[model samples]
Target: MKMTKRNGVFAVVLAGMIWTFASCSKDDDTIPANIEGNAIEVAQASTIAKPGTTVSVALSFADPGNGTMLVIHRDEAPLRSVPLQDGQTSYTFEDILPADLEEGDVVPYAFFIADEKNTITSDASAFEVSVALYDEITIGSSPVYQIELPEDGIIETGKVKLAAGRKYWLPHSVHFMSGTELQMEAGVELYMNTETGETYDVVIDEGARVDVTGTATAPVVVTSDKLLRDQDAEPGDWGQFNIKGEGNGSSSGHVEYLRVEYAGDRGFRLQGVGSGTTINYVQAYRALGEGIMPTDGDVRMKYLVATNCEGGGFRFGDAYAGYVQFAISQTTSFYDEVEAFTIRETASPVISNVTVVGPGEDVDDTHGMRLRANSSGKVYNSIVADFPRRGLRLNDKVTVTDLQGSTVFAYSYIFNVPRDPYRDDTENGNPFRGYLDAENVFQNPFFNNVTGFEDNDEDEPILATIDGIGTTSYIPQTVKNSAFNPASIHAFFSEANYVGAVSEAAADWTKGWVRDYEGNIHQ
Candidate 1:
C-alpha cells in the first residue's frame, strides 16, 4: 500500500535544521585587543548574546602611543591584530555569532596591546549565548530515511536490527509485508514526526514480526517527536504500532522493556497473534485511544502499566483469552470514557495481582471494569479502588447464570468505589446483589497514599491513610501490614505474596522503564 505524503520539502528542511542546531557550538577562542598599561579600561560589554546576533567589544587605552598594535584574544587564542596609530583612543571589534549555538555557552574574549618589546592583557570578559532547542529525528543505517514496502514480496527478510542508543524517524506510515522481521536493541528510540499534520502507523502485516528486547538499564522508547522537548504535546500526536495477523506460534516475536508515549491511536493493536507472543514490562502513557487493544489473540502480558489513557487501558474483543499479571492502571478518567479493562465478544481473560485506580467522585460514567456483551473472565487477588462510579459493571446481556458459571471474581479487594461495587443492567433484577462472597474483601484496601478524594461522608471509612508506602503520591503502594495479602489465596495465586501490583518492600518494577508527563524518566 502507498503511504500518504503530508507536507512537502519543508518537513525535510525542518529535519536538517534540527540536526544542524543540535551539533553547532561557538567555542571559537580568538580575538584581538590593544592596550598597554597596568590599568587599561574597556567599555562595558553586553553580558548576553543570542544566536545570530552580533556582539561588539570596545577597548580604550590611557596612552595611544604610535605603532601600538591592537590584539584581540578569545579563549586565550589570538583572533586578529589591528594597527593603532597615534590619536587612536578606542577601537571596537565586532563579530556575528552563528545561529546554531546552544544555550549556556560562554564565549570569552580578552583585550591586549602588543608591540615588539611589550605585551599588555586585560581581564577576560564573557558573553552567555542562548539558542532555541529543536526536536531531532535521526535516521540510522536504513537505506532511506522513509521507506514504503511493496505489496507482493516479503520486505526486510531476515532481521533488520536497530542499534542501541540510536534513533530512527518515521516521516510517513511504514507497512511491513509478510515474512519481514524487525528487531530493536536496547536503548533504541523511534520517533514519529507529526509536524506535517498527518498521523503515521507502523504496520506489521500478516506473518510479519517485530521483537523489541530491552533491559531495565536500557529500555526502548517509542514516542512522538514533540514529546522530546515540547512539554505541551498531548496524546494522539501520532498513530500506533499495529501488529496484524496470527503468527506461526514462535516465541521470536515479542515485546519487552518498551515504553510508548502519546500515541494518537492505540499504543499496540495486536490482531490474531497467539499466546506465544510475549508482552512484558510494557508501559503506555497518555494514549488517546486504548493503551493495548487485542482482537482474536491469546496473548500473555506481565508487568504492564497504563496511565492517563482516554480509552480503556486494556480493551479486548473477539475471543481473546489471555493471562495478565502485575498490571496497574492509575488516574484514568471517566469523562474520557476510560476503564481499566473493557472486555467484549465472548473474550475470557484471566487477570491477577492488578491495581486499578480512578479519578475520584467528581468524574462520572466510569468504571473499574466493564464486562459486557457475552464476555466472561476471572479476576483474582487484585485491588480495585477509588473509582468514581461502579467498581465492576455487567451489562443487560450478562445474567447471574453467566456470571456464576463462566466468570469468577474472587479473593479480590474492592474499596472506595463511590457507586455500587457490582452493578448489573438486567431489565428489572439486580443479578449481582449478593455476589460479594466471603473470599472477597469490600472494606478499605488501606493504601499508603491517597489524593483527590472527595470529602463526602460516604467515603469516610476508606479515607484513613497510612505512612509506610514509599514514594506514594500519585501512584500508591502497600506496606507489609496493609490489607493486600496474596498469600491469603495461595491456592489460586502462589507466585506473589502481595495483593496489589506493588509492595513497599519489593523492588518496584515500573521504575527505570516508565516516563511521566514531567519528562522524568523513572528508575
Candidate 2:
C-alpha cells in the first residue's frame, strides 16, 4: 500500500557481509496447518554525510519454504518479495545519498516473513543498524574546484571539481565534494545573487574546506547579489550561505577578514558534529534569520560582528560550547529585536565582551537581554543599553536554580528594569514575568560620550557610546527604525586589554574588507 504523506540531510554508509541459509529438504507429504513462507532479513546502516557521499548496505537472510519465495524489507517502511527467476540468490543495495533525510542521520530496517497472500511483514525480526561517514579524499587524488560567477548571470545549482591550489569565486549555489578541503584563498570574492523566493541558495556540505582570509587592508568578502541600497533584499528573503557538517562529524576551516551580509536564513549556520570548525575576524551584516546559529558541536569565534538581524544579533541553539571572544553586536532592529544572546534549550555558550542596543518600541517583542527557559549561561563584562521597554527579563518559566549570578547581587551593575521612558512588557502583548529587580549594577555600564540612548523618531534610533572600566562600546536605540550606519554606531568585546576587537595590533589581519558608508571599518 502506498501512502501519500512525506516530509524531511546527508546519509552515512554501513558495512555488512552476506550470510546464506541452507535449504532443508522436505518430504513430499510434509504439510502444515498454516502456509509457511521464506524470510529475507536485511540489515541497514546510514550516516549523515554531505551530498554525493557514498553509502553502502548489506543483505542476508534465511530461505524458508512456502513453495520457496524470498521476501525483503528496506528500513521500516514496507517489505517486498522477490521471485526466483534463474539461479540468482543474493541481494545487495548501495548508492550515494541525497541532502534531505530523517533528521539527517541513520535509520532502522528489518527483514521477515511472508503471508499466503504474498505480503511480507516482520514482527520480532527487525534490527537497528547505522551507516557512518569518513573523510576519503587524498590531497593529490581529489583536488578542490573553483566556482566562478559570470558577470551577467548567477550560478544556481551544480557540482564543480576544484584544483587543490586554486581559488574560486561563486555567483550562486555550489555544492562541494566530500572528504575534501578547499581553500577560499585570501582576497577572494564569492558573490551570491539569489532572487526572492529561491530555495536553498548555497550549501557547503561535509568534508569540504573554505579558507577566505583577508588582511587589515584587503579582506575577502561574501555578499548578496543586490546593491547595497536595495530595500527589498532582507535576510529572510533567500536561502542561507550555509556552512554545515552533518551527522556527528566535525569540520575545520578559516574565515578571517570576511564579511557576509543579507543572508536569507542565517548569515552563518555552523554545526559541529564530528570535529568542530573555527571562525576568526568575521562580520555579519543585516542578516534575516539568526545572525549566527551554532548547533551541537565545538566551535570557536573571535573578533566577530553581527549587525541589524531581523530576529536577534546572534543565537546559540543546542550544545553551543564554542569559544567566542572579542565580539560586538552594535545595533539590531527593523524587526522585533529580542535578546542580544538567545540561549535555547540544552545550550550553554561562553560569551564575553558583548554589547547590545535595546530597541525603543511601544509594542511587544523588544528586549535588551532575555534568558529563556531551559538555558543556563554566564554573561559577564557586557553592556546592554537604551531599552525602550524592559532592560532585561528573566522569565518566570525559567528555573532559577541554573542561574550563574544572583539577581540581587550587583558587581558593578546588573540591571533588570528599564528606565521611565521604556514601556513594560505587561503594558503590551508581551507580559512581564519573574523578578527583574531594579537597582543592581555589576559594573557602571557607561555610554559613549553622550546622554541616554533613545529612540525618538520612528525612522531613526538614538546612538551613543559606553566607556567604563573594562568595557567600551557605542550603544544606540534598537527599534524597527534603527539604522546600520558605521559612523552612528559601533561596538566591541575584547579578550586582552584593548578598546575593540580590531585595534592597531590586528590592523594587518583584515586588509581587504570594504569600508562602511562613512568610509571606515565596520567595527
Best by TM-score: 1
Indicate the residue-level lDDT of 505 in model 1: 35
lDDT comparing candidate 2 with the true structure: 0.45
Local distance difference test scores for all models: 0.61, 0.45
Q: Model 2 compared with the native: what TM-score?
A: 0.50
Q: In angstroms, give how far residue 81 of model 1 lies from its true place.
A: 50
**Tens digits of per-residue lDDT for model 1, 1-523:** 1111122343343333323322332432232242335233567643555556787766676555776666655433456768878777777778676665533244555555544333433333332222222223343323212222344323656545565555666666777777888777788777777788888787777777888989887888888877554546678988988877673343327889988888976987878777778788888888888888877767777888877778867787878877777887766345465577777788887777777777765566677877778787766656666677667677746544432356656555565665765555655333332322255434222222222224423233232332331112333445423343444433333366555676553567777777753457765
lDDT, model 1? 0.61
In terms of lDDT, the poorest run of 10 residues in model 1 is 1-10
Per-residue lDDT tens digits for candidate 2, residues 286-361, read 7776667777675667766676667676777676555566566644244664665566665555555455554434
Which prediction has the highest lDDT against the true structure?
A: 1
User: For every model shown, what is its TM-score relative to the native structure?
Assistant: 0.61, 0.50
